[model samples]
Target: MDRKSLSLLILIVLLGLCIRLQNFGEIFDSRIYYYGYDPYYHMRLVEAIVLEGYRPSFDYYINYPYGLRIDWLPLFDYILAFPGLFLGFWASEIFAVVFPVIIGVLCIVLVYLISLEVLRNEKFALISAFIFSVCPVTVWKSLLGKADHHIWVVFLLLLSIWLVTKPGLLKLLSGIPMLLMALSWLGAPIYAALLAVSSLFQFNEKEVRIVGISNLIPVLSSIQNLFLGFSFLAIAVFLLVGSFVKRFERRFRYAIVYYLCICSVALLSAYLMPVGWLGFVKSGISYVLGTDIYLPTIREARSFQILGVISSAGYLFFVLAIPALFMLRNGFLKVFFVLSFLISILQLRFVEVLAFPVAILASYTICQILERVDYPVFRKEEEGESKRRGRKEKKKAVEIRKKDHATVIAFLLFLALPCFANSLAPVEMTMDWKEALNWMKENLEAQDYLKAYEKPDYAVLSWWDYGNWILYVAKKAVVCNNFQAGADDAAKFFTAQSEEEAMKIVEKRKVRYVVTVEELTVKPETNKTKFIPIMQIAGYSPEYMKNKEIIDFFNKTMLYKLHVENATNLTHFRLLKNFGTVKIFEVK
Candidate 1:
């Protein structure tokens, strides 16, 4: 790498480190807890593996009275857990900080490489790298020490594509990283699909044949695992399609034979890695179909900004550079650029990783345009009488071209203002539940059970948000939490609209304290909020009991007193009594 490239790389790495290291103590979501539902439950399995020498099994959580099962990809959490194995808890946390930073740096570097290939300009590539590195949405997930797998998935996707384009022994060696990435996150399959499709448009007959033959071993080896094998087959199909479309009829037969061999191996690998495939297809389908099983619109889609403008416009501007990629002589770069751009739009999480490669192609295109518009000194004729004069003119022209290029780049950067602005905001802001946890730990006796209005992961009185984390961090059983899959009937009762239905959970669970956020307490008198009113509204109904009613019942029916209160400058209320966001109340 040149000095400029080296400097840029170092600068990006430092920037990533700074962002990821800040506020490491905060839990962005309860999804980080081992016992939490969905993503966190899977993370705990990896933690168990590292801390207790336990291999994750479907039955890992079966022994618990709760019968919580540990299932999902173990790779991302394994990365987090590996550090814990060697460095202990503090070191593990540090590893989480460093892991995302390294991924972010790699993302920048990949963008640079891809940009250099397409734009053929180092300056543009550098700019692209800087923008991607500092992007807010990208930085937010990477910095938070949690079960989020998007960053690692994007990094591997970039590495895989880079390997395909560069093509070397080292490039071939990139499969290991790709496999590791697949293990780390479910998004690997999506990326692999995009790469395979793009590869068809990019590679030539000879290159396709070579890649087809080269990938056979890995494909065969992974056949027992259908998903892994499919990735290989997908790549082969892309190559075959690319070659056939290029009128390389002679190579078509060979490609077909190679493809069949890959398919056979993929079949075998499917059997071996059966569990790894769970929820992959279902989740992907649900997401695309907009179903309850997948990330709902509210969760996956970003809300309108303060000005009521959607943030997608910034993404649209970045996408305009795709057609510019075709200006490059290489068909491969054009296809790759289009693929990366399209994949990015498919999911918001893919934006950062996708941006890097897209930027690289954009930079290269800009460089090519500069080269065509103005002749360089080296291109001037030296044998003619006017050669010296022409050279001087060419030099001046080159200087002008460089200045113009810089101005154009500045405009592009300005257009990227939204991306820069988004990066400035904190990604993973959350309420500090440490005080509440500490209060519960210090005061509550071992035998005493705290009832939470919402399922807390730990033993403290449960608020809806803290349920999963509480369970994981406190190492104590919880009544009800966010795990809809595991909670079954109990979850239904907690979320029910009827007060009698909700009371059934409270009475049956022997919940001593009802914890809820202040904002969630009000009962709606309109049709909009027909859902269960956790707290009564003053003007709604005579039968609608407010916070005071719950408190009165707790005081009269049992020996009850407020044991903790957590107030903050923020809007959320944290009251230990049944009247507010309760932490704990003693039943005397």
Candidate 2:
């Protein structure tokens, strides 16, 4: 990379860093735990993995007496080992908030490199890098305390694509990133699908064979286990195969046949395993298409509607991107991006993966237009034509501030203004959530309240959305959580017609305490609410809850206590403690 490009990269990354800091005010508050609820779930797991040496499948919190095995990939928590071990809890907290942002900034580099390699134009690469740096959703998810596995997912994906595009020995490194993706996220299979499709045209028999063998490693292990062992083996497989691809290709048809045979065998083994790999496949379908009743209510599961404003996060990007997809000459990128864009249409969260290609598309087209408009950055009169050619030949620095510099500055302001306005406010943590959680942590019985002879435990009954946070902060078991397990019954319990109906669920689950939040509630007098989106998540209709016949029934349940005084006894529930907006009740 030339010095001019390097300088632009640094400046763009700095801009990304600044954009992510838009919500800095919300994260530092002592009263708030984390910006989002899901982060707490991951953070709690990291805490167990770090301080207690706890491993997956040994968790006793979320699922209560049955014990819980988190479905999350383990590498992310393991990645937290560094800051957690050395700097202590505070330092680990800092890492959770900062690490994703740093990764996010560096992603601009890979996107630029990929655009540069594929388009063969530095202008296109630089513009795409700049666009990526300021993307709203990317910035939103990369902020402090928003530490989900997503940023890592994006980086590993982009890195894999970058490696695949590299010439010679560097191309062998592609599998390493793909392996890392398998270690980190459930979406790793997208790589395999893309390659299979891409290879239809650019079919390198030896490369396909290497990938085929690498896939075999997963088949040998038990299904449902992270493919860590196989991931390591894949690196060596790719290295060896890359060295021999040309040599093995003399009988090209035979080599293709062999590769296909290996892939078929590996796939058959994966399906025949005792544990089902098919469940993951089914779950993906259920999640994206909402074929199962569970997914339609999930905000992330919804499609990105072009006119939905916030859901689309600026349609102009897509308008530019769609055109760029057709304009791209790279066979692999074109097919992969089309697949990614289609997936994003099925579920909006896939935007994380789609951003890389879309940015390249949008930026490349804009850069090409600027180039054609006589907006050259290095003027011959200023830099000397001989020096410019010499710099290009040596791959050295060239003056880039002559003409298009003004256009670059103006274009940046245009993109920045909309991104700034559309940026999501930092998830503000409220005092109510903090207060209730703190109270429970201090007050929950250390000795098992139930003497059931088994692992004596207690479970909190709350809405599923808050249950994960309850488990994380209160350090107590909960009947349901964000994972959507048993959510229908949670909704049923809250919206039950009578106390007897509700107590049946509470008794069945061994629930000792009940918690409620007032954040989404309407004024208490009417017991009516406009905030029913979450209620919809649990498979209950807003009208069903708010019907005139059931308005009294809804008020009696008191799912959210808007004020401390609002936590009062009604039927079987006895008021235990009140933390203003968050209140606790005991089943009597």
Per model, state how many residue pairs clash: 31, 0
Predicted candidate 2 versus true structure: per-residue lDDT over 272-329, tens digit per residue: 5556645554454455555656555565666654343233443466567767666656
Name the runs in model 2 displaced over 4 angstroms.
199-284, 304-314, 377-404, 426-428, 446-456, 520-569, 576-580
Tens digits of per-residue lDDT for model 1, 243-278:
555464465645544653565476445434546554
Worst 10 residues of 2 by lDDT: 447-456
Q: How close is candidate 1 to the true structure, as a TM-score?
A: 0.67
lDDT at 399 for candidate 1?
A: 51
C-alpha TM-score for every candidate? 0.67, 0.79
Model 1 ranges off by over 4 Å: 16-43, 58-66, 144-147, 168-171, 210-290, 301-347, 361-397, 400-416, 425-432, 441-465, 478-491, 505-514, 518-588
On TM-score, the candidate that comes out on top is 2
Native-vs-model 1 lDDT?
A: 0.48
RMSD each, Å: 9.2, 6.3
Cα lDDT for residue 362, candidate 2:
78
